[model samples]
Target chain A: MTMAADNRPANAVPRTANRDPYTPQTLLEVAVEVFNERGYDGTSMEHLSRAAGISKSSIYHHVRSKEELLRRAVSHALDGLFAVLDEPAARHGRAVDRLEHVTRRTTLTLIERLPYVTLLLRVRGNTGTERWALERRREFDHRVAELLRQAVSEGDLRADVDVRLATRLLFGMINSIAEWYRPGRGDAASAQEITEAVVTTAFGGLRLRQ
Target chain B: MTMAADNRPANAVPRTANRDPYTPQTLLEVAVEVFNERGYDGTSMEHLSRAAGISKSSIYHHVRSKEELLRRAVSHALDGLFAVLDEPAARHGRAVDRLEHVTRRTTLTLIERLPYVTLLLRVRGNTGTERWALERRREFDHRVAELLRQAVSEGDLRADVDVRLATRLLFGMINSIAEWYRPGRGDAASAQEITEAVVTTAFGGLRLRQ
Candidate 1:
């Protein structure tokens, strides 16, 4: 099982495994859960220490502060997302085709890393780290927008739709995945299925007829 | 020119024109701003008073307390949304057509009442009012999902797509309008243009060929 699955609580903090001592990675996994529950600003060192069964001072030994935890969590999400852009399918295909590949990978990554990504989506640009993450997120959006613009330029997408509007529309569909998706629900649709539906709805409107 | 323009700040308390001094409507406008700023749970009556430029005792003359203010604000947003369901376009058209109308109106309402709607979107099931609002929101979703199901049954929508997925995909496109859509930039698309773009993208692929 993945660390995320083994490490997370269904709705709150996970159990501390007696087998492993506290490390930055283990502490982050606990901190992310507390952050999600009480919210980033609402959570404090006391909460993290209690959840991790570590001294508050010990947590500081591994990370600078709660903000560092947030930065690390969001970075995990960003890295997962940016990595999708470098995949062969995202790079080597027709603009529309490449976009579809990115869209599918994005949905899958979001589902697979549900907690990290959820925290990423909830950011409101309050702190320096948060503002940085938001900037990077906009950069990611612009990169994907460039692909949509290229698709429109190549006549592979509908000419009537504005590319900027189309980009937001595509991302709107992708980002809302965080609002409703829950992992490990017996009846929940698999990430592939969710990605397929999103890609179909977004690209279905843009793809040129043969 | 419109009250909406006066009420646009994400956290600025709205002041009423009446010198009668305080009404529930005016008090709610101020309370919602505080709630949006400090968050529903994070806010206190003192915070509301500071924002409203009134004393806690004076606020009680208008609102019972902070939670009452949250109830009123969410109730206002719920009423606006439910009102859309009763419109002629939403009620009298073909299922697919009606869904498009709902999608458009929902997007417009969300943008027009951006702060209130943003607050509504961010609520977790923390209190009685929040839970009630979430249940109502789910009912609204299920109602729209039923329309998509009906359209598929009538062969007016693509049978390949899942109805629940389609409903979420459509609203994902709509709810996202709140995230980055600024009101008055010279380059910003008008509300009509946005509604049109959202409706077109939402239904373009789903509509059966004539």
Candidate 2:
């Protein structure tokens, strides 16, 4: 073991000399995977390095800390979700229709950004970043709640159920997709089919209409 | 800052001589609170001891291990859920009616056993006990799926949506109550209101009935 002393100059073998360099983008993909698999708290820098096939020093080059990786991932997911609210379909319609449009689009956004949203849904507000994510999540929910209230006032949605409770159940059904949905699994529901299932069950009622 | 070594007999200041002894039931409540606060993996026997105001050795006198506490908690929740299926209303009614009854009751069960079910919902299958809990959960889902299929065949529920997917969504909506519901808290929905909201929005749909 003592015979392995290096004689080569420091410049002879740079860290990135042997293969493609690890970019922040690529490193982030690995970090999110590890985080989702082993929860945000359970994951450590060493886990990320082992998962990414890089050294601790190499990982530091890409991100400042694990929380930075978390912020970047959730921000991507939140960006996708918040954009759905701005869609023309979501914006210019009867309140019920607009609510449905938002629901449909939010479902698609969640499926498209499954890993990120899965991570987002599991945040417990233990850190400043997680608390910020939770606040943003509440803002999104509040916007949706307003849409629901408008729909109820317009006599479109059922007026009997509490609008806030209805909103939670609606998104609850959508968010549960993260717990079980596997995009490429055998016999998986097509995106169109899943979207239809959500909209139809949520708005049309499970009982057949006359 | 070193403490003086004890010179008295061990029985002079026995650990539990002056305290309300830690029973398994109260110990489990403390353990679950800690587990939910710091995830199961994050929690330790030391954490449990600190939360219960007892020593780890005292805890071991009541339960075998942390996993035993997890098993006990989830089993309590699961027993409440599975018992719903055996009720006369659940077992003897029309399939759709039975499904609705089960849904309404399960929602109530979750709210009643909020802490227990909350811990059950967060199990990640990291240990044998968790995996067992997951299997029991899936069995419960399968039973409900069968009820949904029966309802679909009976022409009570709509036949268009996939039966299993509908079952998942229905229960998903029910299960999400664990995330935000705070029993006895100010502005918390009473069990009656919560149950009505779930049943109405789930079966009657959120859209106004003409």
Candidate 3:
């Protein structure tokens, strides 16, 4: 799990504020939070300024438009996820091992980049940025589906289920983490613990003696 | 799967137009579709009217407001899910069997009530009705979590994993069906086939020889 933290993209900003003044990264963190709270369509510059305790002009100073903030936020998330595929483990391992590595890392990335990924999931193809995000998301899913197909061909996974459906369910289980996983909430599991449970419960099943 | 079709609620309106005129149920179906395409907050009575090819006054005659349509849509989905718990298989069977029955039925209900469930899943707690829907959704999750705990206590499920986390992942996988599942889409599996895949993939897992 520490490795998961270490692997977070250098550009990935922590959710908490560390300074009295707002930087672009901090502003982005605040904007993404507000975006998640209020849908992208519902949010306005006034909302962002009020939430940031800054002037509307100050917001414009940081970003040209609200869609810019959305683009930056989702790009951050997409970048983090896409980077996982380039890791040594994901690139050069047995098909199942590579798939597991990607799965665990993807879970960690979602946890680390919680707000950004949540925004990415909520996008409704309403804008150019959102449509681009959707297309990139499809490309990512296709890549993982290919891995699943390879694993099945390698005799590592069950042959009974459709490979594509299996991939959707697997990622579905992973993506749903954003809905309920509140970091630092009451008795919440740490990222490492969640990664382990997700892998085990998903691949190992709930049945005893598996 | 035919059993799934037969089990559709008496009040469940077909997605297609069957009558020459509109009823409240038919109006709701149209409203929910537009609400999903354009988010609930983003949609207007004019949009609903335009999609339904009727005057805005006609829409008001069928429903009081947009919020009413949202409340009605989610309540329909919630009702269908809660009814699954009342069935003989869910109430009288062993904990494992009951859990499996609930899981399978939840998937089928989500499919049968696709548009409504999709709207239900996207509610962001921005309105009174959304808040109510969120509360009802939490209550439903709590009920299923209790069942998982019972299954663990009965020695039917793995005890290593946390029950609450397991339940969230379980429903997360199930709830995500709304994201990519389009009924009558290219070579899509039947509802029964999907239910079987969800059960087997979720409980049996993708690992070979498990």
Candidate 4:
């Protein structure tokens, strides 16, 4: 929830702990939530205004357009995921090891920024901002696909599976987390357990090891 | 494309061949495409009319409301998937074998009914029809989860991963096919190969076999 507040643009966002006294960052948070609840195309600025309990002008004052809020929200998610690729574990290691590291970190990032990442996954390239988001997503997938190819060549990961197909399925399973993972309900697994399950299920497969 | 026509309602639908001719069945086809392209909520009767090259009243004549189209579309998807469970291969086998059979069949079903299933996967439960779709989807998932549980009990599947989580990840990967799978393209893998890849990756770990 505080994710937007943590990375402030200084003058662009007021330093307030409350959801009120809207900052561009905080307002972006509201917009992402609404965009997810009502499909992005269905959501109007009026909906955003109502969700924030503020006037349209108040929303307009913070962000130039709905697309701007969208750009910022998806950027926040993409930045977090791309940052995982830049981490030391992800950057330098045996390719399979690095892929595992990136997978784990990416899952955590999705959880930490659930609403924002949810919106990013649902983007369908209708607007300029959406198209940009899709391109960046493709770039991220390509990087991970390279890691998978390297792992296959190195003989660490299974060579029988197609690298690109494996990449899509692997990330596809990870992204599927957005659809159902709810953090900290009474019966839900802890974040660590969920992360462990993803890593185990992705690399190890579901067949019982002999 | 002929899926909509295969099982027609005796009294409710007209028999037609061309997309422009506007059979109730064919109109449902057009409406499903538009619903998926524009998120269901974002799509209006006007958009459907434009997409179908028919008047709004013409559409209303064929289907009472947009929700009617949605109901039929998702029902087609759900029926396809539920039929997989009733297959002899899926019904009579070792728990793990049945699970794999269902997995392979479900992947093929998703491909066969790709557009309908894609729209089904994206429903968010905003309307009564959407909520009904959500409920049926949950029922379908529950039955699959039961098979996973059985597999684990028989020690054919990994006992360590939670059954529900594994079920989600498995189908999540299968369902993820809707995101990028395009059939019959020049360079794309054949649907047969895609189904094999899903089976291999889901049951066999991505790591090289010893």
Candidate 5:
């Protein structure tokens, strides 16, 4: 297991062989890993260089600072999540159906972009970048909550439960995946299996029987 | 809001007057507040002293070390949780009913002991006490999983959903209260309201219909 060196600032760019096409992506991946291990505050540029086999200067070439890397990483996760909302299935279906689609897609995205989402979940808003990411996250949550409220209004969901509470319960199930999931483990249960379980658990009493 | 000073090591105790019984509890309360604010790794003994309105040496008389305070705080939360299992509702009811009771009690405990539970959830096993706390958390999860399995066996829960998955889903709903719940923010939504919402949302996906 390669660990980032402790000397330089965490976001430092490593001396790359050359300007590679994947430098940004590669550097971001390394940065996410270091951020997870040492935490955003504890990681240093020297650490990134050792992890990425690049010099600290090379890292700076990719991103301005550790917070910038954090922003980029969370943005990637948010983009993946929001893109699912724009999919044809997510947009045109019944509210419940759309919610199912969103849940499934969110699970898949989280798995595919586990490191990014993990970092996003860990943000505490100590910096402007973190606060911005948090605000964006709230917006995403509110958007989904609107769909849930629509479902309840359409008489497809139970009226007794609060929409905000229900929305949180649903995503809580989804976001907790980051705490325990490891990529490439045991066929790792496909997103379908996960989304199915989540939907079933969520809609069991929530949905009106067809 | 008062913030804990971050000048002391994890093992150093604060010094204080020997006669005050409330001093230890007050100091501990202040310590937990600081732990929640800056996180255990980021906080120092000086932070606790300043937060408690006492000198650094004063804190030492009550607790042996910073980790001891963490151990004590989370232990209180853990005991509150485990005690629910000993309640008549949890011990004597049908599997589904017992599970619901446990869920309700756990949510209430989390709210009533918010800071301790928050600190508990944030622990990353970086030290002996932290690792132990994490193990206890897993044990708590496992015990709940057992009750869930019993519910499934008694035909009180959907068998289609994997028991482990369901357990995680349920606890995810409950544990998530720590992330956003504040002590005095909402009107008409008392602590009871939050706990009931969690129980309703959780058991809605659980509990076999009549």
Candidate 6:
């Protein structure tokens, strides 16, 4: 797995005849796959190296440690989800509409970043990265719950259910997308289709009208 | 953690002054807790021993192996969930009402068997027991999906959404209760209340009604 000894610039095209170079981004993708397969706690550097088709030292050259890989993967997922909140629809719409927008976008994001989001969801607060992910997830949930509360107060949603419980059930429905959704598999639903289903089902229950 | 050497049968009450006797049921509970704290693959017999406050030999006395404990835990959870389908409300009603009964009962069973259900949710198909659990879970899901199909055919539910997707989202919302739910933690909702919320949120969205 050693690169050629020639002192070509690191950014230049790879000198190796057959081996693909490992960028941090590519390595992170490999690491997330391994982490999901073996679990974050069960994966080892050797396991990652085998899966990536790279050596341990080569992996270290890209990321310092496995935990760093976890932090990066979940960070990407969290970033995608948190970014949804700032979209024009999420920001400017009526509370119910904004909540629907967030819900749809969040489902799309989870599908777009399936492995990273799956890792984020499976975290059990076992490490700093997992705990941090949990906290950020809570923050995101709270923000959505606030949207639900506002929607209810605006007489747009049902007032009978607890906002916190409603928010959890809504996202719970969305997040479960990661568990069964397989991208590019046989007859998989398009991201748009899933988003529509999630939005309709979630808001259909919460909205006061048919 | 050795039991006193007595000629009495293993089932006899313990002779130890202060130590509580560990029944297989009690031991299985401890194993499930440790398995959840540590990912099932990451947990060892030693870990179970530590958590159970028993010796390795004593743990073996109750169960042949860690996998046996896992089998027991998941079986208990699966039995509870599958039993919901057998209830009269689930078996004989309007398709929509039967679906609602299954949804509400599944939520209550999840809360009632939180740890076992949580473990069931997090299994990653790493071992035989895990694989078996996954297959059983799929069968259960397929059964519910059929109910959704029936409901849609009967015009009790909206036909716009895919029946399979609707069933998945419904149970996804129900199963996620295992992730964040902490029974008796603080002002926790009762099983009946959560059942009401799940039924309302899920059917509220699915039913063809105002």
All models: lDDT? 0.78, 0.84, 0.84, 0.85, 0.77, 0.81
Q: Candidate 1's residue-wise lDDT over A1-210, tens digit each?
A: 125454434224434433235667767877887888888889989998888776777777888888999999999999999999999999997887887788889888887777788889878788999999999999999999898888777667776667788788888888898888776678677788888888778766421233
lDDT of residue B128 for candidate 3:
99
Q: How many pairs of residues collide in model 5?
A: 36
Compared with the true structure, what per-residue lDDT tens digits does model 2 show for residues A1-210? Answer: 001124212223344424435567656776887899988988999898777666787788878999999999999889999998899998898999999999999999888888899999998798899999999999999999999999999999998899888988998999998888887778788777888899999998787776
Clashes of 2: 0
Kindly report the fnat of each predicted structure, to 2 decimals: 0.40, 0.76, 0.75, 0.79, 0.37, 0.51
In DockQ terms, which candidate is top?
A: 4
Docking class of 3: medium
Give the worst 10-residue stretch by lDDT in candidate 3 chain A: A1-10
Tens digit per residue, CA lDDT, model 5, B43-129: 898887766656667778788999999999899889999999899999987888898889889989888888888899989899999
Candidate 5, chain A: TM-score against the reference: 0.84
Residue B177 in model 5: shift from native, Å? 0.6
DockQ, every prediction: 0.42, 0.67, 0.70, 0.74, 0.36, 0.39
Q: Which ten residues in a row have the lowest lDDT in candidate 3 chain B?
A: B1-10
**Tens-digit lDDT string for candidate 1 (B1-210):** 114644434235444322224567766776776677778889888787677666678777776767677777887778889999999999987887887778888888987887678778878888988999899999999999888888777667776778888888888888888777877777898888888878777766422222
- Per-residue C-alpha lDDT of model 3 across residues A94-184, encoded as one tens digit per residue: 8988999999999999999999999998887889999999999999999999999999999989888898888889999999989888887
Better of 1 and 3 by TM-score: 1
Backbone steric clashes in candidate 1, count: 0
Ranking by DockQ: 4, 3, 2, 1, 6, 5
Which residue pairs collide in model 3, if any? none
Per-residue C-alpha lDDT of model 5 across residues A1-210, encoded as one tens digit per residue: 122344333345444545333367666877888898888877888887777776667778788887788888899989998899899998997787787778778888887888898898888788898899899889989989998888777767777777787787778878887887665567466666766777777767321222
